[model samples]
Target chain A: MAIIKRYRALIILSIILLGLSLISPERGTQALSLTSASLIDMFSLLPPILVLVGLIDQWVDKQVLIKFMGDDSKFLGVIIALLLGGLAAGPLYIAFPIAITLLKKGANIRYVVFFLGVWTTAKLPIVLFEVAAFGWKYTLIHVSVGLIFFYLVGVFFEKRFDPNTLLKEDITSNE
Target chain B: MSQSIFLYGLIAILTGLSWFKDRQKTKKALMKAKNILVKLAPELLAILLFVGLSLSILTPETISSLIGERSGVIGVFIASFIGTFAMLPSFVVFPLADTLVSNGAGLVQVSAFIATLVSVGFASLPMERRIFGKEFTYMRNLSAMLMAFIFSFIIWVVLPWL
Candidate 1:
């Protein structure tokens, strides 16, 4: 029962796969193949990230993090957050674990939120791709608007929740 | 594949450096990484399955047809919703968006699609909720969706003036 509860989401997904197979075997097979490919993609990418996270956790001093990205760190904090996020090279899901790690290490909620925001908008490689596909005008509006808007959203989130209590739930907590 | 190779190489070099400095701390870091991977397996599996299911059903062809050139306001919402669910590669997404525009999809609709595609993730919600809790995840996604809309609106207003 405990195992079932823990694996319920995966089970539900399996059932959905089964249902799709029953309804449309072709689509089901496509989904299965795609899922497997992405699963491979994820497994490859995730380990180094987790290792990096763990190393950061064990090696970096919390006080140093707090000093750099803490509530009091102003202009420098924003630049670091932008650079850290904008230079990233992965999907948004990749940013979540990294963001949580920074939060756990005493970074300010505002910067953490802003970092996640910038990650979504301004990943450098993707930005270059966007400029090529959509022109500089379209790409510029997205980066500029995304930055200003998300920073304000960060401020809103900062006011809405306390930093220490923001992540009360453990990473494994599904409840 | 090359990205993975590069990352692993970087990890090897870094871990070697740290191991020389402090074997114990280095070991602890690897152990922590192991522990986190164990704990996160279920959520990761869920995300994998969801992405597979979503991608199969929400193919680029399906997305483009739903976002016709004359789709108007309803089309924008549909495009954003599709963007949130579909996890196309950034490389695939730009070209696809470019194709859609050339094939006559409206700029507003395509902009909404592009905005939410990068920022929002309805598909990754379980992993997000598992990590950041329910409220934070909801707030973040909602805010991202809002940003997507605002971005599309800006494109609609500004491009004409430009």
Candidate 2:
């Protein structure tokens, strides 16, 4: 868990770059050019946001978050997790820590999966970019269908995988 | 763009605060940044150059020929898998998908590929290992891939009617 947490940033950064590289060599170059600029751009948003997130991390503590996100009976936690996940911006790397934090706090596996699934699949900015690049029709088809698919996947994964345990294992191993 | 300026300013302030609070910690943080840059810059440049060469060398006809005609279910699957592996940004994929569609590519192929390109990927594995830890990242990606496949299938079936 310690190692996992420690190396998290490096891993996420590398994955993002890797994704860029696979886009044919020409697109890769453009990605590289954009990476630094994007980093600076992300930095602008991240620092302020991190300050807030960090504060939340510290203040909310793990127990409350867990309880808030863990309560499964009403599916309240699941809904909250999905909403947060759906609304989150940036890349998977940016989302991981927050997810981990929530996990430590006691968010359920279903919620985590929903959060993560949505976070990766749904982004208003990215959606807008897609729409602008493609067309409204394409964007509509993709997002509406994609959301339903993601939700179902989240539900399925939750049933199949023990997200809490997986996260717990990560944390314990890191420790 | 504006975000970059704000971030640089914030980082500057934070670094300054850390310096005043604890010089040693500040120095260590600076070293971490340097380390990341050192490891990152060369690889970034190399990848960019490689992409440039590949794009320049490969004819559009070749790309279209390879991806355009394969528009059936198999084609959609192939394109989505390839796109997932490729990871082209939405901006680039849009024009390319448009071109392919205009040329001869099926809507299913184009849509599926575009979705997969953004939503799922293997190229991101290394970074996923680093940031998300190996198991969690892989699981997440696997889930994404499965979902991408399903989404593409839905588009394949539905979009034509629309």
Task: Identify the leading candidate in terms of TM-score.
Answer: 1
Interface RMSD of each: 2.3, 7.3
lDDT of 1 by residue, A95-163 (tens): 888888889888988999999989988888888889999899989998999999999999999899776
| Poorly placed runs, candidate 2 (over 4 Å) | A1-53, A73-75, A133-137, A163-165, A168-175, B2-63, B88-104, B130-135
Of the candidates shown, which would achieve the greatest DockQ relative to the real structure? 1
lDDT of 2 by residue, A44-160 (tens): 444444443333443465666766777453467757866786655554544555666566667766676667666655665566666766678767877777667766766666676
Error of 2 at A14 (Å): 12
Docking class of 1: medium
DockQ, candidate 2, comes to 0.19
Most lDDT-accurate candidate? 1
lDDT of 2 by residue, B1-162 (tens): 453466557667776776787677556545444443333333333333333333443444655565665557778777766665564433355677677777777776767666666666554454445434566677777767776677767776776677
| TM-score of every candidate relative to the true structure | 0.94, 0.65
